[model samples]
Target: MRELTTDGLLDAVRAWVVIESPTNDAEGVNRVADHAGTLLRGIGASIERMPGRDGYGDILVGRVAGEVNGPGLLLLGHMDTVHQRGVFGYRVEGDRAYGPGIYDMKGGNAMAVAALQHLHATGRRPRLPISVMMIPDEEVGSPSSRAAIEAEALRHRAALVFEPSGEGGKFTVGRHGIARWHLRTEGRPAHAGAYHAEGRSAVREMAHHILALESLTDHPRNFYVNIGIINGGTHENMVPAECSAICYALVPTAAEEAELRAAIHALPQHDPDVRTAVTAGLGRPPFAKTPAIQALYNYAAMLAAEAGLPSAGERVAGGGSDGNFTGALGVPTLDGLGVIGGGPHTREEYIELACLVPRTRMLARLFETLGPGVAGL
Candidate 1:
């Protein structure tokens, strides 16, 4: 039951925030991965860097072995931010660290590392094996890391996701599964002035689909659908031949996912003048609040209470994380076990300086309490 000092944890946060790890920027993300590897190695964890796609950043895996072997616990976080170069400038004002990825992820990464460091310094061993997999591209739906995440989850008993805690440091028990797709419509092009009657407008066809897509939200099952981006018509004078749009849907459960997908696919292609096509599938399966997950949350809450910290039962809602990937495998998963903060994707994103230390201590205490053999297989 050793305590982690606030000053040391703050220093780690400062050091981590200085590195900008935007998701689309491979070089910058890799730089953060390098730094993470160094820190993990120093904490006596074995390290491995898995190469990503040709132009993507690498995934860092750190492992701390225990005396007995069973299903390990996976710690997940992303090194990528949504900010572009020179945007969402980084700064530290007093105890608050303001930056692009501060609250959304980088802060969580720091907390996870600090917890491991605390354990190492005190020569404490966990009851179960612990493995940390820090991947890039979560900000963009984890296109590159989904397979690896699922594989690791299948090999482990449970997973802890370090996406920023809810607005008030509440652990997330469930998150919405997401599906993103592109819609395209095609029509014959003709000169508006000379043969307006001969041509059909693809843009008009797309508009109809957009309206239909919006209607999917009418259901009260917590389904959300949005046509976020639309582009069509090269010039104003001539009738456009093609138009396209990108849309996203969020579902709260697996059954809801199937229902939504069927509805989206069944969208009427009623425009005889234009041909429409829809592409949609599961982006991430919904992470529901199952009984096994409740057990993990109860265990963590008990440890937090013993450590003189606020303890509440698991919270569930619609939001996606790497937890979705793991939960898809039926492995128990818990998310938002990081510092509490808000403004995730805005310039105002920040983490409370006060919660950093206590949250880290909470994580450390959980580690000690769950030390090998405490929870039998």
Candidate 2:
């Protein structure tokens, strides 16, 4: 067996972590893309930079040739995070390496880099070519990059998503489909002190919508609706003329997704005096674990055992990833192959330091062997 260390890998992860690339920040995300592109270019990966649209950063596409030229392995990851600038400090404490995006994905991305570098340095190459796609607005919904990812996924036989792994070395083999709904209510505004009777409150309408929306959550059925953000009103002295609520739904199956979509779009207006509008934003399609996915996991697990890493389990996660798009398209997809960690979108985000080398070896092994002739992809 070959030996590997994470000294350089940790540095690479830290390099990405120090940059604050929230989904809404184009400049920061572009900087991260630039750094990742340069690193991939160093690895002899052909680089293509797409300008970000709809207020997002550029998408970086890097491809490395393989021993053969057939369908390749697609590596999907996002540089955008939910954390804003300087959301938290970065440090290495014991086995936990803390940083804003490190645990969420920078760690996993760095692992991919380390694996490729190891393969390059060792004069080894995978049977199939590899394409690493860096998305800019995945945290929001991949609105700009979805088309590109789907296009690239169709060109590959398999896709490996670099989303953060769960606690205890768990990976996401499947993910629920996510759909975002934006609700807005327009009502008559009047003076609270004098014209209270004439005023129709938009907030009241939105509150009712929230209740109606939340009532759709059914844990047994694995359907969840979350109204995460809301904004309404100007001042307490005047009635709110407009209110908007942004929420998302998680559906485990395609049938449930259809039903949920109908439900969200057909939400009733509790206030007859106000005008209500609903905008259903397309979200990531669900990534269901098929027999093929299970077989892929079995192979990856066998490789992990060969590499002396922990026997990591796979799950159908509720969170969404770029894999949702590819997996839904019948392209074999394996997700959550990033660093093992628990906290995401929180200040306590950290990745297990010990899992670095072994996981990278596992990824490299997957890269080194999986292909049309070598493995079933």
Candidate 3:
């Protein structure tokens, strides 16, 4: 088997870490997608660049011909990060490469690119064709890209998501069910000094709803509710008429997700004069562990051992990814196939620079063999 060294892998990926592509920056994200497209094209892969929609970067879809015909492998990734550009500056200290999206994704995408290069160097392709899809909205629950992601996944026999390697390089076999809602409250505006008695405060009403949402969190059941973004009230002396917030809910099971959804819709009115409503923004259904997923994971462990990488274990992650979309669709999906790293979604996010090559080797082997080797997938 050919080897892609850690140093070599870092060199292949460093250009990406330096390009800060925040989710909201369509142009920035497309630059990353463009770089990926350029790399895929160099390997003789046929490519498609889809225009960005709903204020996001374009999507890159590329394909490498295979040795035989099958549903083909889906190499899924994204270029969006939660951090605004410049919030993180790329730097390598010892074995850690610090950057905005390095650990969360771009590193993983680069590793996949190397795995493809490895295949080319070995003079071999997998039993099925390989398709690469990189989107620009995953960090924000795939609001604009979910449909495309799901459609692309349906065309594949299996999907490998390059989000980030779990701690100790564990494979992410499942993810929590997650959702977000936009909450708004409207009330009559009145002068605080004069008509305060006649006006109901929208901020006061929203406060009640926020507290109610927070109260829905049941730690024992692994369920949580949070209002992360809040806005309301234009002035202090006047009774403000509008209030808004973004609410997020996380749960491990479909039943718990249902309970949380119902609770949000059932919030009682704290003031009859105030009007309130909640609307869906972005979400993922629970990607539950199943027999097929377990089988796929087990075979991956075998592949890892054969590739001389660390022993692999299966885990259920709290966060959601495009993997959540594919896995929920009942496709054989394995996530966290990216570089080993820590502190995602923060300025401190960094990748363990040394784990890149080994992980890429394992991924390359999987790409070369999974379609023909894994049974009942």
Worst 10 residues of 3 by lDDT: 368-377
How many residue-pair clashes does candidate 2 contain?
A: 0
**Leading candidate by TM-score:** 3
- Which 10 consecutive residues of model 2 have the lowest summed lDDT? 1-10
Clashes per model (N, Cα, C within 3 A): 6, 0, 0
Off by over 4 Å in 3: 1-3, 373-375
Which ranges of candidate 1 are over 4 A from the true structure? 1-3, 371-377
Candidate 1 clash pair list? 126-371, 126-372, 127-371, 127-372, 176-318, 176-319
Q: Please tell me which model should have the higher lDDT, number 1 or number 2.
A: 2
Per-model C-alpha lDDT, please? Answer: 0.81, 0.87, 0.86
Q: What does the lDDT come to for candidate 2?
A: 0.87
TM-score of each: 0.94, 0.93, 0.95
Model 1, global lDDT = 0.81
lDDT of 1 at 23: 86
